[model samples]
Target: MIQGDTYYFAVHLSKYYPFSKRVDRNYYKVEISNKSEPSYKFYTIKELSENNKYIEAVSIPPKKEGYFLEREEKHRNEY
Candidate 1:
């Protein structure tokens, strides 16, 4: 994102494992750096509340390059 912009991630887990399968949906505690970024992101979060909801968890400043893909998707849907 930009210098001071904030980004949030929503983690969703589908039904996996036989008896233990469950849906753990929650707002990610922090922004997720893409797979290629230097920091290790929470790809597989172990626990999340089922009814977690967030409004536009990620924010980008005027010149943020990190959420390029996300920006493109948002633009396409807007029009």
Candidate 2:
């Protein structure tokens, strides 16, 4: 993942209690970081009745034009 970039991942949980098993999928946004060895931070995006104004304040802006597109193309070509 690119540093400071955010990505969505589907999380699945498995349970085995009372001889029962179930799977659930949840989406979470993961922000990439390099400040720590872990290299990433995760946050859950909950649905709200109105827009989340806080997101704009904390969101990371693109460094330049075509920043995300260039990264996508580069990653595609690498594979």
Candidate 3:
């Protein structure tokens, strides 16, 4: 198994937010980045939104080197 950096994301869903209707709960379209300059590589999940909700967290290994694999694209649709 490849070792990857960990990431965390949170989505708020309430009846009132900034005095507006609550935004529908959604899954994150994970986009991993090395965050470290000189080694920026990242990769995005193809289709795994349904699996994650509210707060999505995951660990993804580097592509080839220590560089982070970034996500190029992502699409969210109801199934």
Q: Highest lDDT: give the candidate number.
A: 2
| Candidate 1 lDDT, 43-67, residue by residue in tens | 2222221213222222324355658
lDDT of 3 by residue, 1-79 (tens): 1246654232333323221223355422223332322122222332333335212333433345333322222222323
Candidate 3 Cα outliers beyond 4 Å, as residue runs: 1-4, 15-48, 51-79
lDDT for model 3, on a 0 to 1 scale?
0.31
Report model 2's TM-score to 2 decimal places.
0.27
Candidate 2: deviation at residue 37, Å? 21
Model 2: lDDT equals: 0.38
Best by TM-score: 2
lDDT, each prediction: 0.35, 0.38, 0.31
lDDT of 1 at 41: 34
Clashing pairs in 1: none
Better of 1 and 2 by lDDT: 2
